[model samples]
Target: MLATYPIAATEQNWISVTLLNALRLALESLIQGNAAPDFVDAISEEYRDAFVKGPKFQTLYEKFVAKCGILTSQQCAQILDALLDQNNFPAVFIATTTCSSIKDALPEVHEAAKDLFKHAFDKLSDWKSPGSEHTIRATYHQLVDAHLSHGSCPFCGYEPIEADDPDLADPDLDHYLAVSRYPFAGVNLRNLTAMGVNCNRSYKGAQDILLNEHNQRVDCFDPYGNEQVALSLSGTTILSGAGEGPAWTLTFDPDVKSQNWRRIFRLETRLKSSVLEKHYKTWLKQCISYAQKNNIDIRNMDGALEAVGKFKTTCEFETFPTIARLKTSFFDLIEAALNDPVGGERMHNFLVKAA
Candidate 1:
């Protein structure tokens, strides 16, 4: 998971200008009680000339405006709110209108708005302010990096920032809400998340992970939230008093939203099984080695359990996370085995021979 940082004032100002201009024009038309075609013409000119400054499409703009003109004042206000708040405008618009044909018309308006913002952001050119060389994009990343405690990519917990490289590549800035679908959010600070390039660009191209109404709940595992999805080992297990045939598998909590998040990123497929297994094996070997070196009895459950805690404390915090929870769960399984008399004997013998 990732967290958004505060929007820089300059960037916020830049974004505000574009949004306020459009809102001002829309409001002007609403106040005048302009017909659909007239309202469309006024706003389209304001958008194209004042903001986008590109190819004109008067016909499409007329159609989009006509659709908007039919909406009640309350509905129009909701559209204004969407511009400012970056809420689900399409869903809201669709809910307001009974005509299914309006669906095709809305995208033109959204695309124009998206293009306008894209141009303004691109016009900032260097992503830097007047005096400083530090880019706004870099500043945004720095804030997010701090928010994430400078940790590895939250989704996979594998790709970390390359500190030694002079030209370090920052994490890909993913639009939490797809910019193609939710164009109004194209530059919304809250909607952007810094993640691994592969996770952002390849795995989660344009998927709408935030589509479910339940997901918008404050308690859900937001990338910005303090609570994280816990990871563990699954599949056949010998250490937890169950006979094992296959190697353990990595599993996330069965929370449906978490499952959806995992699905969105293809976490199970993308995260290498060998990498997790290696970390578990290494931690286990280190525990057995510590017992041998210090003359601590591996057969003693308390000593073995204490070692697990010590290992977790020593190794969990890192720039590149080594699937720490899954590793801890492996130790938990070992501790469970030690607690059961039959399992304890089996695990003790297994460790003794391995050590």
Candidate 2:
């Protein structure tokens, strides 16, 4: 979740928010006995009035009533206020109690409120921009350049999606708060971020970030915030053996953010399978291939290590490239082992013999 896909200022009032806010006006008007229309320039007050009194609004209202049993106009207004808060999105999400309450109030249907809120929000999906072919998801993709613009999805560092291709379907905009559980955050820019299909669908489906298993509040990483969790790697490389056992330890900070990150993304298990097990041998082979192709001298410890360094330089070992961080860290670990007199000597000897 990098800031590479920061929302543009004008997009704060994206179509999702605009339509929802119009719906908000209808709710308020239901309580105000024919309230004046707060329509955008393109929409007239007559059109707005007819809509609130129409069968479409009646259908949505019926849905909420069926789910919520008894939802008053005052209660609906409060829900709109929380969902339609444009200035501060976090106020709606950060509250541990918000999910349990609806529209500044909660009854038995607080949990059901998520569905009611999303049902209203999903109406925007059908909306077509006048004179344009852009769908709502595609519209946001154009505005924010999609989450994979930085190349790799930072959530797992597994896949780097290309957002520029129109033929390809757009990447999933992961509802960070999970619209299935949270009320009215379906279209909010801050609540929506991108991650790979595996990260979004397989791992973090319907998981609540703010509230833990016991329903307690916990801290978490902000998608656009500067805070980043560091991963510490500790493992040994078996120089020679038929044994498929090279133990690896990937540690994260004990703080809430790091722990929750690990918990939410299933990072520990994923890293073991995806990074250590899959790419460990692949990277080493790449270094050896690079050295042979360039005719680098691997006769001495310094020369052998230099070949490793040079190989890292030639390859795309940066965060934006897929598995770049994995390769970079692996090479660093190799160089550290080679520089030592004990493990380094054995590893260097193995490299020289292989070369």
Candidate 3:
């Protein structure tokens, strides 16, 4: 989860624009197996000239993308806009060259089009100001700030809790980029708007490493190109699945679902059925019902109580709509439990411990 949304650099410097175009071209050629005439036509004379004359284009392009280095929003937006044009449908093929695995994951995407790339490139180029350096930095900062605010983790709206370890504290902005990248793929903002930062970053990354292209079982979930079909909420526990099946059922590449399952939900160990009181029967009943229907086992009383506590602290009181509703539901459960002690103890012993 992120504390803020990310802003995109909608504009770019001339050299950066040039680099993006070169990468798109190279990627397109690699994906399509051959460059389309439209793609050939889309290359700007200036960029084309640079590529022919500059020996370092490939190295520079790779470095920029690898670092998630800043780019102007104008450049990104233009690149995306042009890529989405019907004339540029072929640009998707270029993705294959950029990421070899893309060939199998998104085979249906169209090839990279020349006019669209050229237009996007042109749009970016035109935005260049008198001071290229200052303009680029300003544009980059604006987009980054926007993303930091609006693109927070959907589940918690909490940026990954900064790690104390310097090695881990480094932020992974690209993990959040899933929201933007998907939309950029086909100009589908609807997809972007609906994305959850947790699913996009946490789940996707884990899945990518866990599975290979064929989606077989592995030690981790490789999130690179996986989909999130179901998100299960049990008390404070959040379980995600690739679809309707068990976490282990949907195998493709890494054990993506399982890896995420471990990361998002922690086993509660402090619970004991004996601690049940008449304060949370209703909520307990609901949890039990949900588990029964879903064929989930909650025999571990500690786990159950821990789950209840998790709900109270994380899901119920949080600010998200999902957590907001959970907060209300939990209140009712607590009230019902209080009215009926045995059921309440079974349902919310965690509350008793806190009191």
What lDDT would each prediction earn against the true structure? 0.55, 0.60, 0.34
What's the TM for model 3? 0.34
User: How much does candidate 1 score in TM-score?
Assistant: 0.69
- Per-residue CA lDDT of candidate 1, range 32-145, in tens? 675433423444442344333444334434444554577666555555655654543224322232211111345555665566556444543344544555665666666656
Give the per-residue lDDT digits (tens) of candidate 2, residues 1-355: 3233554512533544554555566556655545324334223443444335445544544444444334566765665555555325545444433443352246444444454446545544454445548655566666655444565666776665547457886667677876655555666666777667888888888888776667777766666655555555646454435544456666554445567667778887888887778877766777888877888777787788889888877545455543565566667777888888778887787667655
Q: Which ranges of candidate 2 are over 4 A from the true structure?
A: 1-4, 9-58, 62-88, 91-125, 128-133, 160-162, 232-245, 251-255, 315-322, 353-355
Please write out the lDDT profile of model 3 over residues 235-289, one tens digit for every residue. Answer: 3311123222111121212234344333442111101111112223444465555
> How many residue pairs clash in all the candidates, one count each?
2, 2, 68
Q: Considering every candidate listed, which one attains the maximal TM-score? A: 2
Which candidate's lDDT is highest? 2
Write down the RMSD of candidate 2 (Cα, Å): 4.9
Regions of model 3 farther than 4 Å from truth: 1-54, 58-141, 147-157, 161-170, 175-353
